[model samples]
Target: MATKFKPFDVVIARYLLKPNEVFHLSKPLMYGAKINTGFGSINHDDIIGKPLRSIVFGDKDKKHKYIVTRARLPEYVINVKREAQPIYPVDASLIVQAADINVSYPTLKSVDDTEIYKEIDIFRRRGYKLAKNKRNDIKNDSSSINKKEEIIQEKLLILHGPINSYNGKTITRCSTPPLQFLECGTGHGSLTLQICKSIHASNCYFDGINDLSRGSIIHSLDRNLKHMKIGISTVSGFQKGIYLDDVEFHYEPIGPSNWVNSDIANYYRQLCDTTEFLQGCFLDMPSPEHEFTELSKYLTVDGFIIVFTPSISQIWDCYTFVKDNDLKLTLVSTFELLTGGNGGMREWDVRRVMIRNSEMVGKVVKPRIGVRIVGGGFIGIFRKIP
Candidate 1:
């Protein structure tokens, strides 16, 4: 039997408009009654059970063919809708490596198996098919009324979870992150997804998010209500919520106003939870300096915080804030990213502050390069020192 496209999988459609022009559009494969691609329209009935990477829809004449294929992470990230300016895929990729996040699988034991089965049962009751598994061989019996596929479906009666390419159609990585990470500014939640993908291995297929002390995760925070909601919705919609549980969204900033009065923080404090604290932090907001002090408190020793500033001057402000506040943090690496050109990133020289014995003990400055060339941003990597 040919593999099929599920209602919620993000997919890509490509065709040649002219001999030299290739056009591509990426969208979630909803059980959409009909999808208008401008090039043409593909009916839901025609596409649901067709083989992938095949021309399932389009102007099928010799002159034009619309090819449908699965969208890769980078492709999906760039092409997906934006709630705010996205952290370009180029930058997001590097941030993962720099963070050295742990996404190891089978890290946590199953919390509850039967409780999960109920949700699966509910998912099946709604009448959605789980993509057939070769091993388990999930069968459909309309008249005989056989066992139902046990995953979630959207309100529209569309299978909105994952299309089980992995053996078990019933698996969901509902565990919290095995390691804690903070994305200070959840702009469009793009980088949050990148980090989750990096550490997803630390999780296994189970259903439901656990309020565990330590699990693999990236906690994304944004103040913009619309952007925050969109970020969560966009991520949850991907591949049917694969990384959705891996990320937890927050409206609280780490600063005094939010965390100081936050019941969430009080809960962590009541438990005396230092071991489950942040392993890494990424800042992609204006005035990231405001976050450093509070972030320092929960950041485990030797944990790293990476800040993204559009200008070198803001980096200086971060440096000044750290030094003046006597925060036990060090500026470890400075990178200048080329934004509009090739998404290139290069190490830039920092002219000040090598802290030793909690003192600014060094001064080295080189002439600025390309004074007028606006790169994507400057990134400062800081480490929490004992």
Candidate 2:
């Protein structure tokens, strides 16, 4: 299989996950996607030695530090002694998912009982046909990701509490690949904090902004992530949380419904002040459609934006607003990463439709949630189109 598949090759398949498969691992299922794992690198050591979650997401301590406290050495050994500090222990759970391979009756028996094994084996061969037949039925299911945008609209029907409160999503951002971005929307701050740790682990820097600074979402997030150290190559949990290199939130009032204040001078000013190229803005300013136009002005052509809203209609409305304003626009991508009920189902729609999608003076890319943040949002990649 190693020789057949080769290294650096790309393969795709829908892998079914068993809970025990990821036991003692980080995540239960590792999607054999672009970044999760490499090609031709699958082996027992690669596969079975460590749990999938740990391999994919966990961190290891490798550096050696020294404490040079000058003291008397043994008789003539040396006046000054050199001692190396022991490596600190690091532990984390990781998840892995296998892909693109045939399974037989024997392989199925390894994980499940006789009755269950039989069902999966039947699906293995003829399941694709069954899926196609029931595609509509599968789609109509509330949890299905295949449903049309109307599902995003439908989730908004039961909005309650603070509009920006936890919508049951976890939003985290990472600069690296694979789980580089995730947005669970379960409203767990730890998910984002953990991802931030992972990004830092990759030796990358992070900065962020939130419109609702005092909101519980932020309060929980701040308390949880406050311990991370913000500068240079330092790692801190709550004990070592990074004081994000650049983070700020300001007031930008938006009228009811959709309206765009194209001349958003103040907003532009804040944008210019940031040193970090990547930033996340979770502001609920009205007319994001128009604000995007104004916001586009400041982006470095390749810069991207992540807008969270419960209204898919509003996102569509943005398309029309950009057109009417004579600002050339196109939607690069749009998809719902998660849905929730507290503050309504939060929808993340990314549009790369820029000053002109094709020939970019600068372009935008919609972000996919990398990890969950406190306020039911995800972090994604966006570049300043240059």
Expressed as tens digits, the lDDT of each residue in 143-254 for candidate 2 is: 5322332332232222111133222233222212111121212122222333343333332222122111111111011111212112111211122134221111111123
> What do the candidate models score in CA lDDT, each in turn?
0.62, 0.26
User: Which residue runs does candidate 2 get wrong by more than 4 Å?
Assistant: 1-240, 243-246, 249-286, 338-386
Question: TM-score per candidate, in order?
Answer: 0.72, 0.27
lDDT, model 2, position 39: 22
lDDT of the structure predicted as candidate 2? 0.26
Q: Model 1: per-residue lDDT, tens digit, 116-156?
A: 44332222323232222223334444454312211111321
Off by over 4 Å in 1: 1-3, 17-27, 60-63, 106-177, 205-209, 253-257, 268-272, 353-375
